[model samples]
Target: MAKLPTARIDKLLSSMGYGSRREMAALAKAGGIKLDGQALADVSDRIALNPDLPQRMRVAGKALDPLQGLVLMLNKPLGMTCSHKEEGALVYEVLPERWRRRDPMISTIGRLDKQTSGLLLMTDDGALLHRVISPKMHVTKSYLATLDRDLRGDEGAMFASGEMMLEGETKPLEPAVLEVISERQARLTVTEGRYHQVRRMFAAVGNHVTALHRESMGRLHLPEGLDPGQTKLLDADEIALIFA
Candidate 1:
């Protein structure tokens, strides 16, 4: 048997994007890790990936990858949770089985609520995740909201001035653009990403959001004809736009 330098399984899994280092260790302890034909005995065990050995290596019965990262965007459909639980509907449920079979697990950078649907970015790249979600970056997210009522005159001014109160609190939002699509619809652009912010901001301005859809995050727009629940790989330019 050709012996390869061994490292802790948890560390290997973390570097492979399986999960964070801490989470991967916990999974290994739970008998969720195996190597060769035997259950993993030590989280720190150095295992040889000898090609000569049958069942050379596996994690949760899945082969491990030593290179490459996965990234993609999904036009998430409403009603799917963002969690990874085996039961109940989740965004992963909509992904093909082949994707789920990959060694490194993909994770969403930021999540959309089950009731709200639009573009969502998922990747195994930890640095990219931090760059997009960190508040200091101030990445703008544009959304189109269909409201139950129309906004005119003072209502339109209120949205632009950032004077809306969210959840009865008096904190002003960043400058936003509100354009009337119709008497009952509007397009809103915001730089701050608060939880349920679009809905709350509209509600604070006395308009109830009936349906909300995110059109873009930063400069990356949902590609034309990407139906709900569809996803496509983002190219270098598309990814760069999000940070730019």
Candidate 2:
């Protein structure tokens, strides 16, 4: 097998937003860093970084945080922008304060407008993030939309026609699935992440979306009862479901 990557203990902790290198050194001196139940005597000592590292090492008496390739699912609430510099409440604020300072900052795989809510994926794994968002991936995203007017009945066929063009866009959209729930509510599943696509789809048909909530991405449904703004770390299997 190939060797695992390694980093100086202090540097690793610092990069993970534990503290500055000086703080890590002081933490080590106080027996706050440990490997295999023994205090790490030197902050300068290097250690292999593997998936199991979180199970083996303890920092300040707590297991190390998930490593760089971490991915998480957030049940985003309405009114929070999926942005780093937007003026109002931001999705990042829901995460631990220190996580915002990690070297490889976590970011949303795609965006949900401030008026929308529901399943949102965030990750520090750049490659995985790109893979999920790439147009070539055709990752399906589903949303529940509550509209201001009753469905005109032809909306389903229009959306699935694969020829509807949103205003200001030059290309036709891929075929999307529309399942009507009530006169004014429907579930829409689309393969693309075009800006405001769901809401725009309704507008193109002369209706207005009053509320929107994402329901799923690919085959992974948001867990039942997960409250708004709550987050769950995704394991390898959960991540694979996105591509499955």
The clash numbers for all candidates, in the given order, read 0, 0
Q: Which ten contiguous residues of candidate 2 have the minimum total lDDT?
A: 97-106
Candidate 1: regions farther than 4 A off: 1-68, 101-104, 168-170
- Per-residue accuracy of model 1 over 1-244 as CA lDDT, tens digit each: 5556655666766656567667777877877776656677577766554433324667766765433245688998888888887456799877765456445567787888888888898887788888899878878888889988877546667767756667756677767877778888888887777788888888777789988888888889998899988888776788988877
Best by TM-score: 2
Q: lDDT of each prediction vs. the true structure?
A: 0.75, 0.95
Per-residue lDDT of model 2, residues 125-242, tens digit only: 9999999999999999999999999999999999999999999999999999999999999999999999999999999999999999999999999999899999999999999999
Clashing pairs in 2: none
Each model's RMSD to truth, in Å? Answer: 8.1, 0.8
Q: How high is each candidate's TM-score?
A: 0.68, 0.98
The best candidate in terms of lDDT: 2
